[model samples]
Target: YTYNNRINRISIIQEHVMLRRAIERGVSTERLATALAINIAQVEKRLNLLDGICAETADLLKDRQCSADVFAVLRRMKPTRQIECAELMVSANNVTMAYARALMSASTPDRLVNAKRAPKPKGLSDEQLGLMQKEMSGLQDQYRMAEQTYGEDTLNRLLFVQEAKLLSAQALTVIAQVRFAKRQTSVDFGPSAGMR
Candidate 1:
């Protein structure tokens, strides 16, 4: 059972790494299975397990009212920095979307059918155009920052996965060996065994 548990944990880590890399590279699970020499069902099962693990991990993180060793390990093992970066990117995207919508409404008369602000100029002056351009430039900067963060997050996650692979492999191996030894051992005692 211990051996199985260790193997399960290692497999979970490996599957997570593989799935993340696949998504990052835009590769489908079917293709990942083919690449990894595993069947589609195996990949799917691992993916499902990973999803469960992720959900549990997330719940554990959210419940600040409790404590668990697993959460501590997960915090260290999981790519939390990448997660934060991704969250920041998402917020930045929302800001960019809002800014773009506002700028577009400010620039185009037909699109501002519902806006409550003062009526904008039917044709933008050089000053207004430059202002719009400046807003757009800021949007571009946000976009670039998001992209850079994403790239760095990806690299960091990849490195994290590599470390997990090594640690998990070692753990699984030791657990398996212990399990094997336990299974092979037999404790035979006479009826007076408890006499000691």
Candidate 2:
């Protein structure tokens, strides 16, 4: 006979509560693991699900359908950001592990539990990101100077749409600046035209 793990497995929050009750009843880790037919580390993980969690965020998520890994991501955030993310999840009606991880990825260092250990931009350090910002601004300044030298008629209108990477609000500012610099825009403004 084949067994289905889904039928035997409980929800992540339920397992957390069950493990808490077991611990209160003087159950040892090994004994609990044996009784539950799971690894001791699994039992330990459930027991510590709320270790760094705040009351508001826990209450917000206690009844939500989220995986144990979501809590792991929440543990990396500060309480305020945890609350904010929880509220956002509730508002968006999505409490998936992927969404939680996305929120974690978008969080700034100030909103993290450990700023010193905050994840850097992929393949770039803080200093590199700073330098890149300076370089981008310089390019924008050059574009403005060229427009001034040749007039808007000589230059083609440009539009920018975000697709490649998640960027700061500054990217939108750049797009707005480019749009403002143009006076007349054509119906099909060449290869670099953005959507209306």
Candidate 3:
């Protein structure tokens, strides 16, 4: 068979959606397997990959370059939790199956789709789970705060560079304006005022 270069690489969601559409259009799993050069069981697995996933979660991950196994892990999570985990994975630039599994393990039982059969992490007690959830929440808050401050931090650095490029009086004036702005914003300027 000739390699089909026209078929560009597709994401996990695309593969699942395509397979699902084929099945819905009365395509046989055996035929799909032959066309994709995979086994019938694998074709069926792909077709059913999004069986229990919510539309919102699927939409969130539609463009993500996650693996099929990542979706498999995500399917165990509730819709809201799935979105949160997907966001974290995207922010961290990690969409691996292992990362998905770690997120699943870190999730609280209430956040799982099958709460009655929630998978327990090895060596993790209930207390540990609670602590992990709290720590994850705190880390997520810190990540958001850092992201919000990133542009301001860049602007501050540029202002410092501009001040350094100017003459002493201009530089001092710029520094004073910056300090005044920082004070107005309630940002700590530390003991740098003593340097002047």
TM-score of each: 0.28, 0.56, 0.74
The models' CA-based lDDT, in order, is 0.52, 0.76, 0.83
Candidate 2 lDDT tens digits, 78-175 = 99989978877886688988888767766666788986776665887777766764674465457557656765544433212343234556788888
Candidate 3 stretches greater than 4 Å from native: 1-7, 167-196
User: How far off is residue 79 in model 1, in Å?
Assistant: 41
lDDT of 1 by residue, 91-114 (tens): 454323333334443333322333
Residue 152 in candidate 3, Cα distance off native in Å: 2.7
The all-Cα superposition gives candidate 2 an RMSD in Å to the true structure of 19.0
- Model 3 superposed RMSD (Cα): 13.2
Model 3 steric clash total:
0
Clashes of each: 0, 0, 0
Candidates by lDDT, descending order: 3, 2, 1
- Candidate 2 residue 148 Cα shift, in angstroms, is 44
Worst 10 residues of 3 by lDDT: 1-10
lDDT of 3 at 149: 97
lDDT against true structure, model 2 = 0.76
lDDT of 3 by residue, 1-196 (tens): 2289776777778988888888889988888899989998888777777877878778877877777888888888988888888778887888889988888877778888887786787898899988997888788889989988999999999999888777777878999999989888896556996678
Residue pairs with colliding backbones in model 2 are none
